[model samples]
Target: MTGHGSGDLRERPRVLVIAEAANPEWVSVPLVGWSLATALRDVADVHIVTQVRNREAFLRAGEVEGESFTAIDSEALARPMWKLGEALRMGQGKGWTMMQAVAALSYPHFERLVWKTFGADLEAGRFDVVHRVTPLSPTAPSPLAAKCAGVGVPFVMGPLNGGVPWPKGFDAERRREKEWLSYLRGAYKALPGRRATLRHASAIITGSRHTASEVPDAFAEKCVYIPENGIDPARFSLVADPQGDVLRACFVGRMVPYKGPDMLLEAALPLLKAGRMRIEMIGDGPMLPGLKAFAEAEGVAGQIGFHGWLAHERVQEVMAGCHLLSFPSVREFGGGVVLEAMALGVVPMIVDYAGPGELVDARLGIKVAIGTRAEIVEGFGAALRRAAESPQALCRMSAAGRDEIAARFTWARKAEQVREVYDWVLGRSEKPAPFG
Candidate 1:
């Protein structure tokens, strides 16, 4: 087996990573960036160019020794007046805007702009490979990969989720499906650069086999299955706290419309009413106002605690106290918090959606079916009830969850797998086989 810091001549490949953001504090993309940086450090001089959302938090997190960091100012992309006009147009079109439509149609032009700006840096030939952690964002042009291709640099695009169709048995309702079709049409209309992007990429990293199955047929051959996010097992271990009375269940991550935080609340409300569990929501987002209102209306306000925007370490501490982590997002690539909780022996209860379902096996955690809103609510409610009634079962699941992480999902292991991809891209004969 190759050691972490072998520094053999076969190692030390120079690579550049481009993403919208790359802070550990920035959720999914950052988690991907951090893990990749750490994994590739021994084998590559990794340089990450990403948008900086929070400058201080990013700086304080420090850098991976063999990795270099560059912050791309994306404030230029967030033109408020332009956004206002776009929003007005979208409202006029029934939540669909013409600018977005135009953007989609002119995606090639957008990709050109990205190349003009970031391509010059890569043209210097300092890096052998270019990896984009997240693709399909308007903010980061896919054409950048094409630029890398022009410079003879292998471009790896990925860890992409959400854009792909949901897995089988997890279909959206008719109404939602219609809405999704409209959104897909708009996406195609708005992002013309996708084909060119895929054409230039040497490989595409997907979070799971489920996501890999959704890769465009043209690029399907180049798709590689890799968990886009991971946890440091040493930092997050199974240290059960016996004194905590409330079987505290926590949900952490951005509170967005599709994230399904409200579903978790709805499921927990009846359990709280029955005096079965206490809930702690340790994140903030647009859904907070409505979720808070719903909690009050359900008369379970006292049983729920909302901790808005806790830092990453604070979140780990919160996970330590919690008995289970509940995430009911309709769309996700990989749930970083799910792995974090599992590493800490907090069994996960996730919606049977893309990311969580892929990560949470029966031994490690529970998966609730997600069909309709009512079905989601009922499924989660039943899981919560089962967890509340069986303390021993929770403990068993928690232990299994930690063991699973140690056996299969550590950053070190994930890094080794990624190094194999790097070796394959380098035209080496000693390529590691595709993960089963």
Candidate 2:
């Protein structure tokens, strides 16, 4: 069935949002799932279906278990699989590929159960759309896509992102992250249900250009480009005060090898010594000790304040007092923190590749070209110098970045973008070209 007479004018589409990892209390994929699904409620009649693990969080967030959302317990398979992944993870927060491999193995069981629970309603045309918001990795194929297609309902999957190949010089970093499965990551495209998932999805929302490129030529027509990360304005309401004489910058994220916290220090050392910049390091990991040692060894410890893993609000509080976010991570899939910094009027100076490249442009913030370790350090150093030399330009970027975040990167704005996909899939209008 088509929509109301005017394509732009239509009833609220009923959507069954499947977010197996959705948790309001969590960060990353779970937060992405929870935020986007709830935001969609403003534009559509949405009923969230999430894994049992997030049930309590959902209830705490005031969602009615049965009416507003449903929790499917796939724990029979999921629990054991999770335990196995933990046991084999090699080290804490390492071996991500192994964990995701374990997840890919267990997730289908969840979907099978989701189909068992929601099949009837979908077949009966009770919902206008079936949207899978989690398992954000493009590596995980959805059998539910084909199932929804068979039931004659539209299926939307993604903003699916991941499989950003480690850049040329980060092999040592790659090994440290325990990304063994990534070597064979492309093989997921050949997995049993992948083609069917892509072929059947009414709209495929890709979160990055790398992910969008992964879509087979045969199914490219249905793809939509929307970044996976967005900021909540309420949480990041404080505007940054960039009035300090020294350029104050903050680096947020796990102090892991790939995140390049050390690289940031190497680049900023000259500025720190000259008292041209003061850096705030937020977050903790194995690299924290080394970073602190480096700061002390350089005698610039006083210039760099290391606040290890502050609460989200506190992180923003620290960030709000700063002028720039210096995040030079070599590999990032979504770069959610960049958006958060922008929302707070903290202009980001990030490596111009992958997620940050897509998110920040010349107008909003600075982009250091992606390169080898030395090149990146030099680039970030130069960018830091430029930021210091021109406080006027920095102030302009502070205002522009915050304004851009409000206009485009908020969860509410992202939901409206998804609504356009809903309208297109329901035959209400021409397909949306979000990039164009």
Candidate 3:
């Protein structure tokens, strides 16, 4: 009881943070893991536990290995599992569900090692709480949850954001991405440790409403909604200022089917042809060549700038010059790009579903209704025209988006919100409602 509840009376709680995928040098989930874990240091007495692979990055970032953090070497099982996942996934950027399925098999080894390494300290109350901040997929169950609960040490899991069902009209896109396993994704709920993981966790942080909805009604009271993605204001220091009759819109994602790069192109075709809007496409993928051909064939190539992948700074520079982040991805679990764009005072125009839908509103940004491909194109097209017609209103939304991100969506703010959850699970305060 040293650090638990009303025992120690320390200003900051002591937390052992588990983030298997944390790496400062990486992107997506790894970057998210690194950011959130490090940010939590500001609000807690923190010790990070990550995989052996991220040890070098942690050292480079000034984290003293074995002091500030500990690296669990589960490579004996993890490396082969990852290679098998790669082999079965069919291609890069496809078969995401297959990869996660493989990961679920290997992650238990990591957690087992964690308990072996830290179990005694946990039972002795060396740390106030144990938080798992990575493997954000809802399908991945944590064995540590039950272990911590058994020890009277609170366990917090997630901002878990994945498992958003594929929309009604995008089966073709799903198939193209080799997501065959997605059809059976629901079966994870019946997996052995899932119920115990939810049942034993002191707090469950749902990263999106869809993920929140996935938590059964029986455990609803302990669930808290806080998106896994957050903006680093330093990286997005530039501000966008679009000053012209033509709408300056940008799309920042993979040029793939579900991302709807083609849909965005088709939607903005009339605007591009009429010289009323210019689009900057800022990523590369299998669809790039086809998109190029379509733009050239439509005679709108001049209005669309196709910049294949750029460095993060360069991407921000491109987004900073634009007025809107027009992303139409239909199946994002965490719309990190939308947050990045909003941080730069760039209003987002995204399809209203999953992560992006939960992030935006009429006050900060625009949301197109989720629908079939044709309907999405029409929706995006009309949204583009309306934005063009009301440039001043768009500018106001841009500023509002930046303000909203600063207040509620930065990593620092996210860490504080998480601290509130820590307080609740530790019995120092009541359960937290971070957003409300």
Candidate 4:
């Protein structure tokens, strides 16, 4: 289960990246997969194998499909089931959870296709490592780990992250978000290939303490904690405009129940009415109508600007124009937007629970203690008031946040950290330097 170091080893390893969602034209996990895969090219000779849906986008991005990347067609295998899931989701009205279930069902086929196409090269030692970068959930099992083990090729899983529970409170928000599937999330461990994937993985990289805790005691030795979310320095540049007397706060995600945008709106109402602050809502969701209505009801609608869905770059621009990012989503997995805000010198005010709670520290920004929904709203309002009254303290935190991200959270830095894990797996080191 351990490897011996090569006396005079090559520093750069050849890696096969299995990313089901690595597409440039798309955002979210697809963008994450694409960014992570490309970043690793600086530390390793990388070849990516992803689903066929991403093929055209990769080609458009200047990667020749069969060479720089290989497209594995999964449409035929997934289409029927995906359609059924979609139809059921529409009928039942809880698409996100249903989509996760559908994705879990389809992921094994993508991994199987990856192995079938590249299993020979892996068995023949053409690649130094096999890293599965997508379906980053610890719940979704990959079939190729055991095959890699048998062939003596090391396999890496994750920066894998998921299963951050709905915190002790917030039952109302959870129920409103239609998280029926959250109740069944734990059953994934009992799935057919779950144990073997964990058992045979040469290294298991977890993103959060919650997911890291889920790794069984037997495979715990190989588990390393490295957050999966990272910032793209090129896209999210540091731009600190001089602060005006009017403090501007922005909430930049979907306006969903779990995301807590309405809670934020309520929290900032006092500031909005007193002309002490401005609130910008920069993304659209099903809750848009309700959010708008609530703002109007509170008589602060004029103080809040609803910029319905923006392009990725535009969203950053909106964020940069603001002073603080108010994101209290209690169930976020990566909270990449938090890092993006920090990259631009905008301090974040986040709830202390899941991903945002894990990333933001006292020095970087404020973490409101989690409590009942009303408590959270009141806490956020108090935090906003503190910022309005203390510009110097806010300035200090903003500078520190920008500095923190440049040093630790950039994509290149994250890639280097992953390379350390690769080296450790190849027997070049005892373990990756602590993922701070």
Candidate 5:
């Protein structure tokens, strides 16, 4: 088990999946990383390469370290650097500027470890491809792109996402979030290996229009847009059955300024006060106290359920009981919860701007156009009122959203799409038509 199988040269292409963050015990980027890596197995023979931190969890999940996945013991270099960055970050995302620096330091070691262990096999054509599937952050450069190209093995990067700019007129929110280095976010285009990675990559998959546009014009041909989020249909086994007579709406996300949880409350106040609708506010963050107080002050607290930060499964259960997921995050990157809601047949109402905006069209759910904070709040309220009053219309949207998810947004579907890309890269097929 100390070595890997070089996959039969005539069989399915062997792929090395690199995801430093991939671990089943974790959530967020790690969950996406792990899921995507595992999903690739249905289409290609794959060996995942990840960090030492994920080893125990990987083993617990039934993976044999050297064979199924390569656990790169890079913590000696990664942990200290992470600690230093966290200290400097000081609980402020600051547009993720500090973390990008930390990533610049740590991510390379992951690539180095991969090459150190498998460079010989790669050189001998043991694997047909190398795909770096994590650090989903586009800012993190993969030194392996150049290395892979040098040996004639195609390298693919991304589903890289991030850098969605804040909606206009939210400077206060920007400062509140300690986005000090936001102004220089554009400087990432100048990172030492960024351009080369794009230039040499066999393909670059982007998760958002913002991320797609980040690729330079010259490398645009290689850029492909595929959302970085998907749902496990089993997690949303709750049929679209309502719990009560009132058409309930739910908002699930961190109670942060950018997330617009306050806007959900402000928008739903009229319906919540009238007993025509109920609200379930899930998840917790710095904005929780204020959101609770705001509901009480507006006299709609009785109609709203404040269940802060439920487990993922519980969140789905709560979502199943509701008719819609109302999210107004101005800077959302994935609107992942929205997809989960859709998978459960709960329609979503999201601000039409960044990630959520791109995902929702007239068919999926509601898109509240981006505008001044006041305008967005008013638009969300109107959307809530409309959905609350019309059961038939809301049901139609719910069915359509779930159908859309089942048809195009599941991991199974994404892997098939990725398979298409592989065919294109290997000359087994022509460039794929754009994702519909």
Candidate 6:
């Protein structure tokens, strides 16, 4: 496809977005996809290819304004035999082995199916650029990147999660990450075509400077730090509640091991014990039962409320009522929830690690020091006490937090940065320009 230009400036280009999952109900990925689509609409013809878990829910969610949506049926590639083998292996307590085997056996076939089903239109050179949002493993590059390359289109690889080596510290965790890396290396060797596909991509976009720095010195030159996530400041703005009672704290998003819901429960125990605060958990996941049990055991059961999973609109409403947002997650590229809380004028008490460390300004919110369970508990307790003792301080931090997000983080700004990367990849720009 030929590039479009208006006068001396390039016209809005057509961009194809590929993601394994983009169901709106799925949380993070969907939000990222939707935001990107919305932001790029003015400058590009955006077409998205993503798997829909629930067709009805997806349809109900409707198309993001100004972008074309294409739904890929995952059922078409759900190999029963592979699933059975994986299930059996998982039953035997070999989860990683099972996952690896299934991915190795099924990914290529799945990729082929996706191509046969959707590649013709894509390969016809209808899109000027291709962007992959969820690059979890080499499988992400296997057929998608290869197809884009085959068509002579510039491919942007990014928002990729796994494969990068974990940071130092946490001996047991590091050992497991090394093992996973070993397996990934073997998998890549076995799938040379997939490896080459990703290596040939025009550029790789990452969510943070931390991720961009860790992009393997081999691809470091190709790596670009363009945050693909942010909060909708307007949606999370502060609200006036004349009858609001008790200090409400909220935990939003998935309840998983790395998310540190357990940490929040532990930290809230002392506050709850003292009847100083009420906790509201607005999401559900595998860790819900454990979190609930811990809260009950700590004698704060009555004070805690679990709203399960709520719609996006409702979540914003719940957030508006919150006095603070407590996120204890240990692993995150950057927590969009933290930004959401900040935008909503809720002080965030986040762990001093990864995402929070990078985004949280001490002047805006508390960054609890990373340490043992007792230390974390103590640190969070101290932050809570500080907020409680000084309402004026909390108000100041809340205003600053909102101001910071408005000034630095926004989907419009993030999308424009991504578009610049696309522009550079397509040879429209000679050098990477600052994404204002």
Clashes of each: 7, 0, 0, 0, 1, 0
Model 4 clashing residue pairs (backbone):
none
Predict model 4's lDDT versus the native.
Answer: 0.84
Each model's TM-score, in the order given? 0.77, 0.97, 0.96, 0.95, 0.95, 0.78
TM-score of 6: 0.78
Candidates 2 and 4 compared: the better one by lDDT is 2
Error of 5 at 339 (Å): 0.7
What is the per-residue lDDT of model 2 for residues 1-436, given as tens digits with 9 covering 90 to 100? 2111112335889899999999999998999999998988778888899999999999999888878899999999999999999888788888887888889889999999999998988999989999999999877779899899898899999999988888989999999888877788788889888888899999999999889998999999999999999999888999998666888999999999999999999999999999888999999999999999999999999999999988889989999989899999988999999999999999999998899899998888999999999999999999999888865678888899988888888998898899999999999999997662
Q: How many clashing pairs does model 2 include?
A: 0
Tens digits of per-residue lDDT, candidate 1, 142-193, equal 7677677788888877665544354444344223322334335424523455
Evaluated at residue 2, the lDDT of candidate 5 is 21
For each candidate in the order shown, give its overall lDDT on alpha carbons: 0.67, 0.90, 0.90, 0.84, 0.83, 0.65
* Clashing pairs in model 5, backbone N/Cα/C closer than 3 A: 283-309
Ranking 2 against 4 by TM-score, winner: 2
Candidate 5 Cα errors over 4 Å, as ranges: 1-11, 92-95
lDDT of 6 by residue, 22-122 (tens): 55555665666656555565566666666555345446766642235655655655557457755655333233434554555555555565577657767
After superposing candidate 3, which stretches have Cα over 4 Å from the reference?
A: 1-10, 434-436
Model 5: per-residue Cα lDDT over 210-247, one tens digit each: 88987888988987788998777766667677866677
Top-lDDT structure, candidate number: 3
Tens-digit per-residue lDDT, 34-56, candidate 4:
98988888788888888888888
Q: Decide which is better by lDDT, 1 or 2.
A: 2
Q: Candidate 2 clashing pairs?
A: none
**What TM-score would candidate 3 get against the native?**
0.96
Sort order, TM-score high to low: 2, 3, 5, 4, 6, 1
- Model 6 scores worst on lDDT over the 10 consecutive residues at 1-10
Cα RMSD to native, each candidate?
5.4, 2.8, 2.7, 3.6, 2.4, 5.0
lDDT of 2 at 116: 97
